[model samples]
Target: MINHILDHRYELLEHIGGGGMADVYRAHDQLLDRYVAVKILHSQFSNDEEFIEKFRGEAQGAAKLSHPNIVNIYDVGKENNNHYIIMEYVAGQTLKDLIQSAGKLSVSESLRIALEIAEALEHAHANNLVHCDIKPHNILVTPTGRIKVTDFGIARAVTSSTMTYSGTIVGSVHYFSPEQAKGGAISAKSDIYSLGVVLYEMLTGQLPFTGETPISIALKHLQEEPVSVRKLNPTIPLIVEAIVLKAMEKDPNNRFANSTEMIRDIKRAESGLLHGDRQNNAISNQDPFATQILPRVSDSLPSRKSNLAPDEKIPQTNLLKSKKFLWGLVCILILGFFAGAFLSYGKFWSNAEVIVPDVVGKQMTIAKQMLETKNLRVNIAETYDADVPAGEVVSQYPAAGTTVKEQRLVTVYISKGGEALEMPDVHGLTKVAAETKLKNMGLKLGKVEEEYSNEAAGTVLNQTPRSGTKITKGSAVDLVISKGPKSRKVTLPDFSGSTLNSIETQLKSLNLKAGTVTEVTSSKPAGTILDQTPAAGTDIAEGSSVDFSIAKTEKATDKNTNKNSGKDASKDTNKDTAKNSKPADAPKDTK
Candidate 1:
């Protein structure tokens, strides 16, 4: 229960989140003197040794990853038969809530979320872990807009459990990978596939695939191609759509190899940093016809193997004997031919002249064929040349028309992409100015950091790419703002002549605090204020405390007189009484 603390160390405060297998509570770790999020395994799962082992393994694995975008796991333990994990307590809402509330996000905003998620996945993949669940629900968007990925390795544990039971996918159906839908082995590519689904949902405000049941939805992931993203949001960049489609390809080989590769693509797409060949309307670039004609993927079927004809299945012993005989015959023919031909043609071949083929600007495969026709071998090397498109030969070692010996190797360099330019600084500028500068410089602006400042209040004061610093084009620039001076000024109220109650009210009105009050003998009445520090006209910061002394009227003098002792004293007392009784309103001093 939320009211319960674990091992008396984590004091459960309130219920923050829950799912079928676990419940999360906001709690305070008294030992650490900080707040933490405690996720406890559901009672049903606690008794399962397999589930417990998996959960423990995932927790330990996630604990090894240190990334700003990923939630940090602090501690793991069991108390009173309850298994719990302590993690960072982030005050924010999930990305799902944000997307649902906004309906849809701007291209730039969606790019921001995508990039952050990609970075988190990149780190996890590098550390040999996969999030397995890259959905809006697992991403927390802070008040400042920074994204923190939660439930990292926990998904792997959950999926493992699901895998043990046949015919079930581990993750959410909406973000399932094609392989996942088929209940196949999970890998880093699976995470990439889920990320693609998350990106699609963010850009188009809808899931690419959906159905009445989890199985049906998953089948769509395996068998159906999603509708183009640009169809739903015309403003979606062609490059972004291409990246998403590539990541979500049903064939794992066609998708990114890992989160790092996927992240690189996302970053490039977000920054318009496409390789040259990939430029010029990436959306229109379709998969090659050869790829489209690929043999049916039997891996998608429940039966992991395809049916073969009886004749197609050769006996193992016969197949091995045939392979050995073919190898022996080919070797003998090659030796005899070389022995005879070398004696007659070796001298002529050594003196033979070959013309260098013109292969520059041609695709690598085509260029290689062209070079081979001249009795010259091709040595392919890749380089990033800005002027040449990717997959095209940017340069050749042997210039066109040059003469070389037969079968000589000609080195050709293929272009990969353009050289990246260093990013520039544009901090302290207004939003409009920053946007214009970043666009003009071919750079991208990242999340801005705003805070209260004394100098340059409410204005941009600093940026990630500080002035005069160089960074590659399309790199993110983080901006910082001034929240305004830490304090404000207020004019001290004129409490010199006002009563203590009235002065307190005046101070309250001015947002000033009142200090200790001391009563002292003064000419004014008992309740009236005497004087205040930081005089009335002096200006002081708001919330400053003011101290004043209230007047204490002189106690009536107590003295005894022998008035009734003598007639003379009696006559003097009578004279004083007559003066006092003359008129209560009249002052003795005035008379």
Candidate 2:
């Protein structure tokens, strides 16, 4: 797809990267005149409705988040089946690459990168969004050491129910939370857990958990605890290790409450390091088995030491009675506790159980009625489905046959049909503006053709499929762009040897004009053209000016002087003849 343009705005320049879900490319934004990253969903997933939803979800969710450490999303669109997202192009390497090259990062660098990632998460969580997928592959680090957390492909909005279905794992197994491994509900703390794993990797140069298979690794996340960061790298401070541990706690409640809290802790750790405060790092330097003095015990029982010195058996009966009374009290408390637990268990067990009816492919209204008839509550969710008709049930929870207690909430997903919108008019707008509008409306730019028209150049003259036509998302719309009015060319002809007036008339007929005319004395007749500025046979635009040189006659005074000189010579000859003949004969004798 290189060289292909998406939405007529982003032109794919080169393949930059690829993952299981999409291929990333460096693209040029024609409208903005800037470079951007374009991620196009793999063709295999393009037709899958579930994948399409998730791909679109990434754009929708990430677009709402704005932070310096979070890559910015500029646009989202599809051309035919190719779904794409335009984002800020980060010219750097992935965190994974950094780890591989360096084997591990310094303590300070790791904390700095982690802190930036946490801040990004803080922003996303504040907007009520959870980034389900956070891993080194998604983290980009610039040459200047700025961190960018990107790839919210599996991100979803925070809601009352955000549980992952059983057997469905959405993120990288090694970096996901324990709750995510168990397909439990996800929250902002999940992102914190993933970030913690990333920090561990940065400090240790290896993943916290590894196995031959994904399932095995996921099980490790659920059942095992990772080795402390300090164990792998002794240079890591105790407080920094503690931060990683807290963020990676198995239970979400045990982890950082949110990214904000995590950020605060990270900042405090950085401060401790910067100030050379050994208190936080002193734990590793302390002696584990150091001895300490104990306080002295005081004598009780009314100076019993001296009074009962002869020892003896004076209070044996009283002591036995007290011991028996204590045992009796313990037994009574145990019995009471069991009784309460039994009663509570029986109360819960007494609720009637009902089978969930099959509602997949049923109309939403009918499905609701059916579930209500079974005394079950319905929780509805809507999603785009190209194969399923609108309002039809796509799937139901609990397998539609599992026994559930009365009043149990059964979530039913309803189809919203194929995503579509009415095409909008883009005529008369510049190419860039037209593409931007179409992309925002979920349309793709199709083949662009240029034609000469009275409209301004680069302006859109017309569009295919017309406005108001309902088109599905990712559908392409062709456009005819204006190249301005057609130009007329004129071939200059030889004007030499032609009269000046005649040349002017010819020029006017040819839509050409005569420029400055210079007069020159030549043998040719007056008013005759001598030379032309553009020579001859030159192609020029219509109405262009052409310079020229014209011939003119010599001055009349010069001809009059030559005639007078000839007459003077003739008179001189006549005088000589008269003197030679004596009046005619006298002049002959003298000769």
| Per-candidate TM-score against the hidden true structure | 0.47, 0.49
Runs in model 1 lying further than 4 Å from the true structure: 165-167, 273-591
Model 2 CA RMSD to the hidden true structure, in angstroms: 28.0
For residues 1-591, could you state the per-residue lDDT of candidate 2 as single tens digits? 899888888889999998766789999999989999998877865666755665577568778788999999877888988888888999989999999999999999999999999989888888877778899999999989899988764444211112312124445778888776655567889899999999999999999999644555765787789998999999887778889999999988888888888887788678768876554344224534211122345633355546665746555467556978889888999988866654322223447888889999976546767887887777666766657876578898867898877767788887766676788999889999999998897778999999999889999998988998887766788999999888788899998889877776889889999888889989899889999988799998887899988887778999999999999999998988776755533445555
| Clash number for candidate 1 | 11
Q: Model 1 — which ten-residue stretch has the worst lDDT? A: 286-295
Could you give candidate 1's per-residue lDDT for residues 167-200 as a string of tens digits? Answer: 3444687987877665567898888888888888
Highest TM-score model number: 2
Scanning candidate 2 in windows of ten residues, the lowest lDDT window is 157-166
